[model samples]
Target: MPVISYELPDRFVAGAVGQPGERAFYLQARSGRRVTSVALEKFQVTLLAERLEELLDEVRRRGGDDAPVPAATPSELLDDEPLDQPVEEEFRVGTMALAWDPEGEQVVIEAQEATEGESAEPEVGDDDPAIAVLRVRITAAQARAFAERALKVVAAGRPPCPLCGNPLDTAGHVCPRQNGYLG
Candidate 1:
């Protein structure tokens, strides 16, 4: 969700007579990026910005503009008062950091350097890799997609458990995945 540009075309005159001209613009959204062109008369351009503002206002009121991805939760976990903190899960590839969230189901995949003591700022670029965080209410199809992508990414590397930082070499373990009973 970046504001790539906000400018008027040079060909279109602000107060020109005759038929109204057309204008084009660019906007980049999260799901995908697109270049949109609008054909409007000179008078329409001024109104366009205001109209867009009003439309955005309405969208905000309806909670449709920039709506956050809802996190997933088990039915039993949806009590009035949550008993425990949100679980912290980490998927790793080699020594690079991927996505991270304190709470919520949205998985953000972006590359960030590991600072020895403090949280390092993410490096900005077109080629940076990302980690996807899944929500509790994510559907089976969505979950499968997330898992598949993560597998493809981590498959080329080994991941260490977040708790013990031990490499999960095989299926044998008494960790959290084993229910802690050590059967």
Candidate 2:
């Protein structure tokens, strides 16, 4: 299956169309006029942002950021609305990874489709093009912006319980740690 690769996206963001925990999480990359949306777990979005930040930090430590890549400001290329209405999940993500391409001088994020249930096979092979893989490339500056935006977006969800660390809806939640006690 051919991978949907976006090399140096002009606009990239991780966004949710609906309320947190009740909505889908997507990683969108747009180059020129081509736009691709890929489905992923909310935690994946959080981890992706964190890892991207780490990658950029490593580059800076190694003097790679000194290149003429031109630092990109998050606000300048940010897309609050990454996708069109009636958002759909391209595929349920199974495994994902991130790496810095020294030659390419970009952070590459790759996500593979997760197969249903458990598998006994020694190896996994996907022949479905529609659910093959999604890859996005972005710069160190863009990564920093993404990390900042993603942290904010994830935090904007339901506030967490101070004691139990569980997300509390507007109606609150019956935290098991409270043992039937609202307080």
- List TM-scores for all candidates, in order: 0.18, 0.80
lDDT of 1: 0.28
- Best prediction by TM-score: 2
Q: Give the poorly placed runs of model 1, Cα more than 4 Å off.
A: 1-30, 34-112, 118-143, 156-183
Tens digits of per-residue lDDT for model 1 on 1-183?
221221221111112112212222111111122222222222233343333334334434555545332232234322222112221213211112123222443222232222344344433233323422111222222322333332332233335665654445456345575566332
Q: After superposition, how far is residue 60 of candidate 1 from its true place, in Å?
A: 31
TM-score of 1: 0.18
For candidate 1, which ten residues in a row score worst on lDDT? 8-17
Going through the candidates in order, what is the number of backbone clashes in each? 8, 0
**Local distance difference test, per candidate?**
0.28, 0.71
**Candidate 2: worst-modelled 10 consecutive residues by lDDT:** 118-127
What root-mean-square deviation over C-alphas does model 2 reach?
A: 3.9
Which digits, one per residue and each the tens of the lDDT, describe model 2 over residues 83-116?
6545556676777777777787777777777776
